[model samples]
Target chain A: MTTSREIRLKSRPVGVPTADNFELASVELPPPGDGEIQVKNLYMSVDPYMRGRMTDRKSYVPPFELGKALQGGAVGEVTASNDPDFKVGDIVSSMFGWREAYNANPRALAAAGPMGGIMKLSTHGMPPQAFLGVAGMPGMTAYAGLLRVAALKEGDIVFVSAAAGAVGSVVCQIAKIKGHTVIGSAGGPEKVAFLKEIGVDHVIDYKATPDVTAELAKVAPKGIDVYFENVGGVHLEAALNAARPFGRFALCGMISQYNETGRPTGPANIIQAVGKSLRLEGFIVSNHYDLFPAFVRDMADWINSGKLTWKETVVEGVDRAPEAFIKLFSGENLGKMLVKL
Target chain B: MTTSREIRLKSRPVGVPTADNFELASVELPPPGDGEIQVKNLYMSVDPYMRGRMTDRKSYVPPFELGKALQGGAVGEVTASNDPDFKVGDIVSSMFGWREAYNANPRALAAAGPMGGIMKLSTHGMPPQAFLGVAGMPGMTAYAGLLRVAALKEGDIVFVSAAAGAVGSVVCQIAKIKGHTVIGSAGGPEKVAFLKEIGVDHVIDYKATPDVTAELAKVAPKGIDVYFENVGGVHLEAALNAARPFGRFALCGMISQYNETGRPTGPANIIQAVGKSLRLEGFIVSNHYDLFPAFVRDMADWINSGKLTWKETVVEGVDRAPEAFIKLFSGENLGKMLVKL
Candidate 1:
């Protein structure tokens, strides 16, 4: 028998989640059952949407239960396997909980689920951690949400919020590849610089900028055609005012309002959507699972051709998973926030 | 030379248009030239969109010139024609100004402009006035806006505001014909009764029911799947709250804000759209002109089969056009508001 370290939800959070909401414990790992794989967890993702799951309200996906291991997308090495499909030493990404080690049913680790939880990584010329960051769910989200939902066309101007985060980073790159002029908003100078390095046409440090709409107007004088919405509230309002007639907004997440005590105030200029004849659609990456194979092929091709780039902020220990998750809300992570056990 | 009575824009108004903002002038009609047709106007349409054209600001279409005749969809008789395609006594519709009579280039009066503003009427099996109402722009708006833009599917629950108005009246009928459960909101008890008589599955009188959201909740407990938006502001807010996850909203018009003093206060709960992954799209019926042939066929079939019904509130004499136009803002007209010359 071996000890496995795990982080479980101690209590539901009211506003932003804290360390008090999580309890770390060490439990004895049981032997792998038939058609199961015992894996040593290597990395776990700490995403902004995890904050929504900590609450007790009904949402697109279910809320996390108290005293249960918090589940997220994780990449690990299989130490033991009773299933023929997976073997010892085989590295795979799975919907494994936040833990140091665990035995998972092979059936549960099949492919991407309905809520867009997990998927196996294609071992091309990319880092294994990329599976948890840009080349994984976040990458697929930016691709499908911007291309399929927003119907981004060549020469269109794009504005991405939370610009240097996992999803936004990929969104900027994808927009550039599609021959669109891209402007992004980040919270700090370093992230803004990173965005510039990745070929973003323009970057704005939202923290230092007093007026977002004015800044956006200066960068995109012709007006934005596509707005990849990740941060809501003020960012949404700015995008709305800066958008041209017949603009399209692809809403993937609302990180700013995820942990609010009550309903967060939306953009004040939403009426502009009507006058401009705008198209605004909200979507989840999981809803497009049917297109995963196609996404993987295209993304891998971009990576191999030196057109795609990715970054990850890795936290070392499983015991520190809660802290890493909390850092996502504070905008501390530059790109994807992950825990390496 | 014949004297033509015309209504011209005197100045741009701040809020509700007044008599002082318009000038009724008696001008001499120009003689028809080669390829020109002299139109003796018989009827003129007064629509909510005319308010937008009254402003100097650019919109979907250009703003109406301050000193020029206010153009609208009008049906008239060809008193004289120098064009090979037209003849005397031939009734036709064109984007003619608010005038008793005028001479226009036949090329300018060809089929219809970009937004399908005018079309020759077929006065078969219907009243001649029906060509300006149900078989005209409002009817096509309902058909294309609901079916093409909203992508209405069978069994979907639809909610429409300003249900007794021209566009909304047709929208409910189209949704019903597609096998959808249709609910509508009108201003008074009389309008509510009219909505029910036209085969709307449910009706809510917004005046008697102070809480529109709660009223919608009682009828659409599963929440609305599609919202055909006509009245904006508070009504838009109610629809946003009552919309289900992945719901679609087609924003065709916003009559509520047309006469507002400034930027009207919009829906307070728009953040719900992000959480529910809803899709809200604003479109002009003219954008889907390629689908008009199909729309005319479908509408004609429904009308002839007794599956579709229509109503009109006709105000006689072209002099009453301004009064009829003002009544749209007050929600005083049921179905289409037309003025006969």
Candidate 2:
């Protein structure tokens, strides 16, 4: 048996999660059996989506079991291997997160479906943690949601909320690279500046502007052709009002409303969808695994050419996983939030 | 010169439209010029969407101008043709409505764009009036919203609100034809009976059931793959509740909240969209004209095979246009509502 430390969900949160909601515990792990691999995790990803898994409700993904290690994306190195396809020292990524070491038989996990597959990472001389950030889920999300979901086109004016975060940053950059005018909304001047540096044509500092819709209207005077909805409520309403006829909205995530105590008020003006002939579609990226290889190819090219940039605010140690996750809701993290093992 | 009778918008209605908002007038029309043709109207369509045109809001389609003739789909016969394309006695469908006679230049109208294209009808061995309903805008709405907007698969079980109405009726039939189980929700026992006659697998009398979500869960215990939204609010919430993972919602209209003075609470449970990975897309049939030919071909085959049945609630005289339009919200119309002139 091997001793491994992990983060566990002690309790579900009522509103914004507190430190008490999570617990750090040491667990015992067995050695890799036949056809299995043992991994020593290098990094654990703490994302907004993990919050949903903490809630005890039936959703697209199952709720994280209480007192069990919270699962998420992790990049690791194989310490022991029994599978012929994998070897020791091979870098890989899997959804078995918040733990220091694990023994996994991938073929056995595959029976659980799409959520189970372990991906072998080709870093191409980049840091392993980069696989947990822009070169990973966030990057693929922006690409698939834009091209595949919204059906974005050239000359289209795109609006992105949470514009400096992981997915939003990539959305704005891709929209610009594809010959579309991009508008971004971030909470502060620092994020606003980052958006500008990345070539967003228009930027709105939503924290400074009490009325985001009015600010958006000023920046995007002609109206937006596509809206990438990352924040719900006011942000969604602003996008709806600013969307032109036949606008398409790719519903990625609604981070702002995730921890609300009661049912948050939806965009009151969603009826505008009817008047504008809007297509608002919500998608989970796991369903679109077929697009991953193409995404990685294009993203790697962009990074190599210095046309793309990635940001991360990483907290060290498994004990601090709760703090890192809590910081996401607080909006203190600059971009993708990660916890190091 | 010919004296033509038309229905004009006197004033915008506050809540539900009344006779005070409508005015019948006689206008003199000049002779058809070089390329123009004069048409004598036989049938005019009054639909729920026209209600949006009555208001002063800037929408996908322009609002109705006060003291001007209300425009919508109309089927008529050409009385005089100066253009080689159209001859006298030819049946044609145009978006110039509530008028007994209209002089139109086909080329000039087509240049104005998709909305202005006047389609000459072959009657396809069906009644010319069918062009305004099952075989025209509403029929196309169902076809496009189902196949294109929803991206429905063969095994998809579809839930349709306003199931006995024009668009909803066709949506149910098409879903059934595609080998999908269909659940239809209508306001009364009569409408419920009609849905049953149309081969809807399950029927919900929404008026009798206070909790539509419960009713839907009872009927569609396994959950639905697609929801064809006609009446919004409660129906949308119910569909959201009854939706399986990765369900598609083709949001055609929101007849229930159309006349609200204030912003009606938009499906309080819209957050369910994120959990379910639901796609809620609102589309105007006009934007999907590219699929019209295929839709017409399929619909013609269905009609010829006696697999498709169409019902029309026609009110006599152009003076009763407002009454016909008002009847739509009252749930009195059995199917496609029309006014005969």
The fnat scores of all predictions, in order, read: 0.51, 0.59
Give candidate 2's whole-model lDDT. Answer: 0.89
How close is every model to the real structure, measured as TM-score?
Answer: 0.93, 0.92
Show model 1 residue runs off by greater than 4 Å.
A108-122, B108-119, B266-268, B316-319
Which pairs clash inside model 2? none
lDDT at position B196, candidate 2 = 94
Output the lDDT of residue A276, model 1.
85
lDDT for each candidate structure: 0.83, 0.89
Residue B268 of model 1: what lDDT?
54
lDDT of 1 at A285: 82
lDDT of 2 by residue, A169-283 (tens): 9998888888899999888878888898999999998888899899989999999989988888888889989998888888888888889988677677778887678888888
